[model samples]
Target: MPPRTSLPRRAAKSPALRKIAVVLALVLAYQLWLVVQAQGKVGPGVGAQRDARGRFAVDVELGFAPERFHILRLQKHGRIAGTDGHVVHLRGVAPAGVDALAREYWIRHIEVPRRGS
Candidate 1:
């Protein structure tokens, strides 16, 4: 039998290229939106301070509406316990803009600190 001639092969393009690009663009837009939301924004929040009794106490309040704050107590304390016998004392009133700011802050900060020092 005679030798077989070699056939030309078509150059390959990644089939998933378009899908990957779309995903990247969407992620970028979401991140930009979050930045715009958090920039120079002072949302309603309370800062906690540990008292001599080792109880978490929130002092000082910053927000737009006081009555809408629904804060019966300016400072509230809570005790958190772990299954492994770990206990954490936490105190704070739920902030007004916490729901909206939480997402923006989390995305921008990437991780939350145990406490702001």
Candidate 2:
């Protein structure tokens, strides 16, 4: 009769542990992708600028009508000094840059004025 041989407990669990590690790595990669996507959405705009007054000059797009009310909420940061069609021009103290306004609703894009302009 042949003698029976049992696998070591750690060796038996190796495959399961490897599977868990792979899943965790995949999840981490997916989370990183999501962060990149969000950051791209709020990337600094071309119209962003800093004037002699120390205020940031920005062009904000308040998507479609009715939802335009969101512009009012932005007044808390600073007033909408002007508008050309649907795009609202803003001059404010944006210490964090244009991306700081990304959290506001209906704000599709914030175009920052170019430097030295």
Candidate 3:
């Protein structure tokens, strides 16, 4: 009778396969780091100022012009109060909407609007 060999055991013994696996793991780790960095773009207390309607105001500083269009698309209910250079003042943004904005790599920063000008 012939003995059956396991495919996983064979893969574990191959140096090329081990190298490929290590590279894939490193790539995945880098991707996760990027996600964390992107989410960190949101400033402290930015999401803490929800109004009675559960919407907040934020100053979204973008990396470029086209990103403004993407932000407008992501925030359908939010209105652009003003824009100074690449910074856009968005109001009526829900918590979920803010999270979505944070996930965008093109968005450089998200912060609570200041009291005055």
Collision count for each candidate, in order: 0, 7, 0
Q: For model 1, state the Cα shift of residue 106 in Å.
A: 13
List where candidate 3 sits over 4 angstroms from the true fold: 1-3, 10-31, 66-68
Clashing pairs in 2: 47-111, 47-112, 47-113, 48-111, 48-112, 48-113, 49-113
Once superposed on the true structure, which residue ranges of model 2 sit more than 4 Å away at CA? Answer: 1-38, 41-48, 66-68, 113-117
Off by over 4 Å in 1: 1-15, 44-100, 104-117
**Model 2 global lDDT (CA atoms, 0 to 1):** 0.61
Best by TM-score: 3
Top candidate (lDDT) = 3
Model 3, position 67: C-alpha lDDT score: 60
Query: Model 1 Cα displacement at 110 (Å)?
Result: 19
The local distance difference test score of model 1 is 0.36
In model 2, state the lDDT of residue 24. 95
Model 2 clash count equals 7
**List of clashing residue pairs for candidate 3:** none
Clash tally for model 1: 0
Which lDDT tens digits does candidate 1 get at residues 24-94? 99999998877676554432233333356533322222232323122332212232221111211224324
TM-score of each: 0.31, 0.49, 0.65
